[model samples]
Target chain A: MAKGSVVAIDIDVSRRLGDRVIAAHFTTGPGLTALFGPSGAGKTSILNMVAGLLRPDRGHIRIGERTLFDGATNLPPEARRVGYVFQDGRLFPHRRVRANLLYGHDLAPPANRWMSLDEAARFLGIDHLLGRWPQSLSGGEAQRVAIGRALLAGPEILLMDEPLSSLDAARRGDIMAVIERIRDELKLPILYVSHDRAEVDRLATQIAEIGE
Target chain B: MLSPEEWGIVALSLKVGGVAVLATLPVAFGLAWILARYRFPGRVVLDALVHLPLVLPPVVTGWLLLIAFGPLGPAGRWLESWFGMTLMFRWTGAALAAAIMALPLMVRAMRLSIEGIDRRLEGAARTLGAGRWHAFRTISLPLALPGVLAALVLGFARSIGEFGATITFVSNIPGETRTLPLAIYSALQVPGGEAMVTRLALLSVALSLGALVLSEWLVRRTHGERQRRGD
Candidate 1:
């Protein structure tokens, strides 16, 4: 019956380069928290562990009232109910945009399903591109579709790991604006990892600066 | 025009090859998926076992199959006792032998395709409330489809061309297990059978070439689909 204590991580794992260890311990309530750090700072690594994609060498991860990972209990990624938008968009190449967006909806509990297809598409400004293939989309359009896909999955927490880093400056601004809109309107907890200080400043309510 | 007897050999070869590919495909994909996606102990041993037929001489492979699947063998006896099925010297046994010969190529092609896929896509699927099976079905399998098609083509072609393994496992018997290659071999053994030899030889070449062309077309279609979508 507890909510809003979205993510608690006290873990140590090798950074992306695998040369050194980065230890982190933090807890954030419902809001957009930015993990700002330089390249190779292990921001994505931490996010990955949250999504159950990777396991921390030693630590506990509690999202909401659920103990996701520890010595005893390790929930699979599918059980975590975390939505992730990657840097590359990672949209299903063979699936049409609509199908990609609805993939998570297929498995999400009905009670937890809040966002509709039209609502997600319109919010992300991808209503018209739903029929097209992901490979055909421009960088900005693809990222929007990715966001829409994640949103439709009915996730308890959204993880954006430099979702805009691959976009050009103009596209970056557009995506950042959409992300801000999501944070304000959805009120879901998010861990947005990025190196752009301005992006962190503009959208993040809480900032955890890592690396240089 | 070919005689019924000549046509039977052609028809039998096609049937055996087609059935072999169908049977091998499920096993090939399962093994290929495991080899490409998971890293566990003795993975190399499993890989080696799958590829053993390819490396060994065809006669040796067939001898091994005969020992394992022959009516006197434990597996053969169990199958006969339990299911009333007998693989010894039957056309079905020919198909099994052909499937074994074709399996390595199919697995190799499928494994390459599976490996080429981005694992991160599956990761994305998992976060979206998809379990391991769902992610594999929607993401991994679809993305690797072109490769799978290619594997099927390769398997089919290899099955059609299968000679040594089939003859070794199940001896040539007309109307039962005498496929194109076996028929051709029999024709060559008879005196003044040079014309029948020529005809069967032409048929075998045409069939093998047809499979190759079909495989090539499949691979091209996949590539075109990907390119059309701008991948």
Candidate 2:
């Protein structure tokens, strides 16, 4: 594994579910790297490890120049500037759309406020939806909000864990366009997890196949 | 005739129960979060012990409190020496007994609510730079607020109706430790005071119904928020 600009992430994480083993070994760079695998192939686990939600049994994870996890140095999720988008959108239920977006912006350092709340809303096409509550959002709309929230964090990297899995095909198509727009706009790295090969082909510049 | 003493009993019961519940809420929330979200060794044992008051007779709970908080007990002596406070045969003693009885109910309701929240929401908070407590305060606590409110109201109602533990620990001393339930029990024990007990019973029913209505309103508001969220 080379420690250089070309590889934005280097991970070798293994987890066991009783006797079964779901393991991954990969190094990904600035563009989108999709982890394509079957169900239960540990796609989500890898994303969780990168986001510091699940500690890998024995491995290391580094994003850019910072070490997010190692056997000894497992940075808590808050300390690791890695953004995560769960499949269900996971919007803060009590928060209006603007407050949810601001929640992320507030956590960011002052220097990262280059993308103001207004800019973030405009970028995500969510300006009109800001005052609305989360329950009012369609599946596509909610995922778009989730993406904007993550981006507002000024994270060094973003991890999407099967974000379109719960949506209908039509909804997924709508979000795919939003995601592509995000990729074009942000220079940050993204580790996208999905079992769908078509999504991988459409979104990923690099592909890491997990499981058998 | 409904005497002023009856009103005193009602006021005392409300005061003691409300104070006890308010005092225990922060602790109950902490315990519920620990039980619902974490997996530490002996956690199951701790959880079971918290619920022991529910299963054990209230008189037994009172007996335990008496042993630990009686005038001659070590805790009682320490409280007197350190804080100049006493619990034996006092209204404070009744509050203590009620708090112990109400704790499990509060914890259980909060625990269920905490568990019901999508864990992914907390994970989302963390990635947004919230530490554990921040995540809980902003994400977990708000989402599970309906359950927390339910727990508090249930605990308050339970404390108001406390009898066995209050009688055993604090005794039914008028104007000192006699709660609504204790007053009602004493009235029933007398020859002609049964009519007085009937009025008190109606009061009890009214208080409990009020609490239930409040809980329902809170739940409806939270449910409406969830509906708006499209969940």
Candidate 3:
């Protein structure tokens, strides 16, 4: 791996879904890597392993010289400092936009607010939505909030799984701008996932097509 | 024709059942999450046993309660010695019985709601640096609010109508333990107490209907919010 490179070594994981293998072999790399494939093609599984949500049967994940997952040294998601944004933009429904941003801020150590709550909101164009409940947000708006929340945590690397796949065409266009802006503004590396060729071309710096 | 003595029973019943439901909500939520999200040995057995009270005759449940919470029982004895508190024949004892009876209902409702929540949301939380408990409090708990409210209402309704278990475990001590159902049963046995029975029965119907309407309104209101968000 090159200096400051994010590398995911050969990974093998399997789960018996009533005698059938639900997931199998998976491996990939960093720098806006795209896990492009059809539904149930094990794309999400690969992302989950990288995020430490699913422990791999055998593999290693290293991001920017930090060992996130290895045979004997497996770090929990929080400790790994790997930020993951899901396809559905899971904003805390009860919390105000500002509070949701602060939630991630609070979880990070008190070193320096690398991305302050105000900075995150402004960067994501969600400053006006700081006081509104998530229930009041639009589909595209919620995705932006989810991304802002992830960024505010000051993670070393960000993983987004089809962040725009759920939005309408218009909404998808609007969110694409926010996504591109964040990618350029933040020095941290990102691993974005999507099966849409247009979206993959638009955002990804490198593409790793799965099951192709 | 309910005398003031009977009126006292009405208030006592509401007091016990209301407090019991209130106490069960938080505990039930925790247990429900454990059942809904985690996989562990004996989980199936634990799930079945939680519903045992629902399947068992209320009388049998009452007897078990009596044995376990009677003055001579171990838990009851410890309560008396350690906290100078007594449960047998007290209104608190009736509340305890109602809570046990209502617990499974609350857990079931919460479990369903928790299951409905997207696990991917939780995954997002974990990557955002939330610990397990923090993720639950901030993400899971909020998303499952509608279900939690429904559970509270259902548990409260179940506690209010409980009769056999309440009567058997706590007995019908008029001033201390006799709740609405016990009072209605006692009134039925008296001569010329027809008017009182009619009044109490009406009250029960009114209370239950009010809860049902409240739950419906709550469900509609939350559903609207979710739809608007999706839009």
On lDDT, the candidate that comes out on top is: 2
lDDT of 2: 0.85
- The per-prediction i-RMS, to one decimal, reads 1.9, 2.5, 3.0
Poorly placed runs, candidate 3 (over 4 Å) = A1-31, A35-41, A110-112, A126-139, A167-180, A197-203, A207-212, B1-3, B39-41, B71-86, B228-231
Please give the TM-score of chain B in predicted model 2: 0.93
- How much of the true A–B contact set does each candidate keep? 0.80, 0.78, 0.64
**lDDT per residue (tens digit) for residues B1-231 in model 3:** 667876786788789889999998888988898999899999999898888889999999999999888889888888989999988899999898999899999999889889989887777788878888888787888778888998888888888888988889999887888788888888899999888888988888888888888877876788676656532
Ranked candidates, highest DockQ first: 1, 2, 3
Task: Name the top DockQ candidate.
Answer: 1
TM-scores of the candidates are 0.91, 0.91, 0.81
Per-residue lDDT over B101-147 for candidate 1, one digit per residue giving the tens place of the 0 to 100 score: 99999999989989989998898889998888988888888878877
Q: Chain A TM-score per candidate?
A: 0.90, 0.91, 0.85
For residues A8-104, write the lDDT of model 1, one tens digit per residue: 4333333334666765567676778888666767888888888899877777877667787887888999988888999999998888899989988
Report how far residue A121 has shifted in candidate 3, in Å. Answer: 4.3
Count of backbone clashes for each model? 0, 5, 0
RMSD of 3: 4.5
Q: How would the docking of model 2 be graded?
A: medium
Better of 1 and 3 by DockQ: 1
The per-residue C-alpha lDDT of model 2 at residue A10 equals: 88
- Candidate 2 ranges beyond 4 A from true positions: A1-7, B1-3, B189-195, B228-231
DockQ of 3: 0.46
